[model samples]
Target: MTPTFSQLIRSPVLFLAFGFGSGLAKKAPGTFGTLAAVPLWYGLQFLSPLAYMAVIVITFALGCYLCGAASTKLGVHDHGGIVWDEFVGYWITMFMAPAGWLWALYGFVLFRIFDIAKPQPIGWADRKVHGGLGIMLDDILAGIYAALVLQGTAYLISHF
Candidate 1:
């Protein structure tokens, strides 16, 4: 039987599970899940960039623990519902980008490609690792890849 929203949210395993629920939508749940992180990014912007980066670091660390517990409880491997990783990964992807829709869109596209393609080390981590940290690490790598590519693209554009 399918679990209710409350059951999913209230699970002791991970607070990120509730956020991951955004990924449960019929279409592009991962995208939706990433989108769900926007408000959080905005809210976090109040802190200095350093503090914001620290928060992301903490969130990733905590996400590792929470995601592992929640994934076990749900009896699914990297279930769609566990998208807190995506949220954090996407946030990381936009690290130095402007807070405009254009940049957001670029980040969305870049993150999605990296997440979906799972190139090299990201793919290696996804396969060799287990639990929340394992689950989130791949996405984090994807975000990093996207960030690097986007940063380069922006630099190239500026030089033109």
Candidate 2:
């Protein structure tokens, strides 16, 4: 049986999976969830590259478990309200990005585009995979795509 909203709120895992309640937004829950990640990204920017990578790895592992558990409780797969994937994805996109609000904003826009567009392999994974890994894989791929673009853009700006 699926848990009610009240029950979902009571569980710590569900709450984080829900993006600290940002996923509860009546409209564009995914957008809100991604927005909620901005602050987190800002703080994470303080870490060294190695530490940042470690944190992301940890977060991704936890996201897989938390997302799976939450989906099981809700009796749904890849529910829109579960946005822990978004958090990790955005973090991945912003990794090693230029240090500034502008770069952060760029990463945000790029991540959202790749995530929503689900281009090529991202779309393939979203269609073929299931459960927690499924929920996380597409977003991870999207983040990679966005990171490539962001990094390329940064390189061009520096060289040109």
Candidate 3:
């Protein structure tokens, strides 16, 4: 069925709910979904870094509330359409990367690896939490892991 534009913009909760659908894509949907976040991320760039981080924090908080409701409404836990979490998570991933294509590419690869692999704390959060926060926290941690790696990689590349 075609989703209405309103359904597309879903009450804040449903908007995040739609992000989960990205996970449902047959291949590389998560990467594509994360890439979709770039526009929003670009919009956030006008804000000071602190302000940008604050927006991400707020998005995450809202994600938990809305994503949970949408999941229950859809009778699915972490349904694929709830990609707002990915948006937020990936934005957070790019938080520390250098502002360039190369760094963005590295951030994307690292974020995807940590996200898909669910390494360490990410895996723990994925397993222990439920609902929207559970769905989002894993990616947030993965983003953090990606950011750290990207930062370090940048430092190394500069020295070489």
Candidate 4:
């Protein structure tokens, strides 16, 4: 069942899994959830590249558990409200990106496009994977794709 706001707030895991209530938005929860990640990405900017990677690694592990647990609790697979994947995905998109709001915005747009479009292996993982790992794998792939594009764009702009 889709969790009510009260239920979602009351459960710590659900609260995080739902992207700290941003996923509770009535429409386009993934988009809103991704937006919630923007500020976090800003804070993560202060970290050294190695530390930033560590955070992503840890968060990805936690997301697998959280997303899986929430799915089991709700008896739904890949619930729109379980948007922690989007958070991780956006983080990956911004890795090594040029430091600026415009770059962040570009990463945001790119991540969303890849995530929503689900090209190739992303779509395959979404369809074939199961459990929490399954939930995160697709978004991880999307993030990687977006990151490649974002980094490539940065490189091109710098060179040209």
Candidate 5:
């Protein structure tokens, strides 16, 4: 059965899948969802590389289920309001990013672009995949793309 807005907000899984209510925003919910990930990225910055990776893996796994559950509850596939994928995606984009608000901001911008643009394989995955894995794969790919660009930019800035 499709859940109502009130039910979604009250449910723990849905609340998270919805980006802590950021996804509830009527305007640019995806943007807001990505913005919400910034603080989480900052908090995660202190972890060791291995630990960070582990967390990312776990979050990705959980996001698949959380997002899938929320999607099922809402009776829609990849609903705009289901933004846990955005959260995990942004976190992936910022993984091991340089220490600074500037770097975080850059990661945010790049992630949003790649995610929204859905170029090449990312778009392919979006079209071809379904269910929980489908909901998470495209954004994960977008995060990887953004991460590559962000890392490349950081590399250039540091080396030059």
Candidate 6:
């Protein structure tokens, strides 16, 4: 069942899995969910790289269960409303990124592009993987792809 805003607000799991209601958007819920992550990213930006990475690791691990339980309740696989994956994915993309909103915006666009395009193994995982892990895997791949590209671009711009 597609969770209504009321339902999302009422349930803690749904509230989190649905990206605090950003995923309830009628159009491009993933995009909205990713956007929601940007502000939260600011909070983590000050941490040491190791601490930041630790947070991502924890979030990813917890997300598997959070997303899975949510999907089970909704009786759907990878519901668009199930956007906790997007949150973690975007965080991964921004890992070690420059401290600025421009970088954040760039990471957002790159992550979204890779996510929507779903090339190769990312697409493969999306089609083949199951449960919450399945939902998170594709976006994780997309974030990795985007992070490589973003880091490369940042390096080039800095060096040139």
Instruction: Say which candidate scores most in TM-score.
Output: 4
Model 4 score (lDDT) = 0.95
Q: How close is every model to the real structure, measured as TM-score?
A: 0.89, 0.95, 0.84, 0.98, 0.95, 0.98
Q: Which lDDT tens digits does candidate 4 get at residues 1-160?
A: 6788899889998999999999988999999999999999999988999999999999999999999999999899999999999999999999888999999999999999999999999999999999999999999999999999999999999999
lDDT of 4 at 95: 89
Better of 1 and 6 by TM-score: 6
**lDDT per residue, candidate 6, 129-151, as tens digits?**
99889999999999999999999
lDDT by residue for model 1 over 42-66, one digit each (tens)? 6775677798799889989888877
Please report, as a residue range, the 10-residue window in candidate 3 with the lowest summed lDDT: 1-10
Cand. 3 Cα-lDDT: 0.75
lDDT of residue 99 for candidate 6: 84
lDDT of 2 by residue, 1-160 (tens): 3345686679998898998888777787777888999999999999999999999999999999999988987888988889999999999999999999999999999999999999999999999998898999999999999999999999999999
Ranking of predictions according to lDDT: 4, 6, 2, 5, 1, 3
Candidate 3, 59-81: lDDT as tens digits: 88987877787778778777665
Best by lDDT: 4
RMSD of 3: 2.8
Per-residue alpha-carbon lDDT of candidate 5 for residues 10-109, written as tens digits (9 for 90 to 100): 8998888988888887888889999998998888999998999998999899999998888888889988888899988999998889999999999999
Model 5 misplacement above 4 A? 1-5
